[model samples]
Target: MKRTRINKYGIVACAILLSLSKVTLAVDNVTPISIPMVANAQVFADFTDDIPAVLNYFTSSTKDEIIDFYNQSFGESIFQEKNESALR
Candidate 1:
């Protein structure tokens, strides 16, 4: 009974910590802008493709090149992290 109680408390504590971390990370990284946002205002028509060829034009090396390009283009202060994940 005591062990089960401890496990429940431990899980709750972990969940709380994880949520707090996410909140802090988001808040710390936010930049203030003067613009109030509008919802889904599109200047261009939507794509008509059944299966969109997103990123297919980009070669494998384009991923790394994109990161480098953005870092150079934006001068690194606005962009802090680059993370890439792929599933087989």
Candidate 2:
């Protein structure tokens, strides 16, 4: 009986911790891409025009953006160097 009570208390404590640990995410506001429209691109045009935006959505760039902000705060030259190195 004591063992069962201890188990019950342990479960209750676990449940409380689990509930507290949950983080509610805000709704994803990014619009979904229309594959059909993208497929309809002109025959001469590149098919990957919209691919960058789609790919960038999955890659969180908050760190890069912050770095860029600090770099730009210094001057355009440093920012340009950073962009050039990224291209390389």
Candidate 3:
């Protein structure tokens, strides 16, 4: 009996994948052109004072209620609006 030949397509696919991986590694080795954190560096430390106890009242409540209230109120402003559906 004659021996079967290996598939050429599978070998070609593997070679292509290997070459792509090398290109990816070469790109990653380059230094980032600029520092990324400049905009985000000052984001923290906005609240210097102690967090108020009132903030805890929010966490104690059920999640759905809190989510509904939050989505309805557009931040703190919505609490003043009289929407019975949102209250439910």
* Best model per lDDT: 3
TM-score of 3: 0.35
| Candidate 2 lDDT over residue span 40-60, tens digit each | 233333334333432222223
Error at 60, model 2, angstroms: 24
Q: Candidate 3, residues 1-88: lDDT per residue as tens digits?
A: 9998999999999999999999989867764332122221333323223233112121344645656666665545434545789667
How many steric overlaps does candidate 3 have? 0
Give candidate 1 regions above 4 Å deviation: 1-6, 33-88
- Assess candidate 1 and give its TM-score to the true structure: 0.30
Candidate 3 pairs with clashing backbones = none
Worst 10 residues of 3 by lDDT: 49-58
Query: Candidate 1 residues 1-88, lDDT tens each?
Result: 3554367888899999999999989777755433211232332433323234211222344445655754676557654654455432
Please tell me which model should have the higher TM-score, number 1 or number 2: 1
Model 3, position 62: C-alpha lDDT score: 63
| lDDT, each prediction | 0.51, 0.45, 0.53
Sort by lDDT, top down from the best: 3, 1, 2
Name model 2 segments beyond 4 Å from true.
Answer: 1-4, 24-81
Q: Weakest 10 consecutive residues, lDDT, candidate 2?
A: 35-44
- In angstroms, the error of model 2 at 19 is 2.0
Can you rank all candidates by TM-score, best first?
3, 1, 2
Alpha-carbon lDDT of model 1:
0.51
- The deviation in Å at residue 43 for candidate 2 is 17
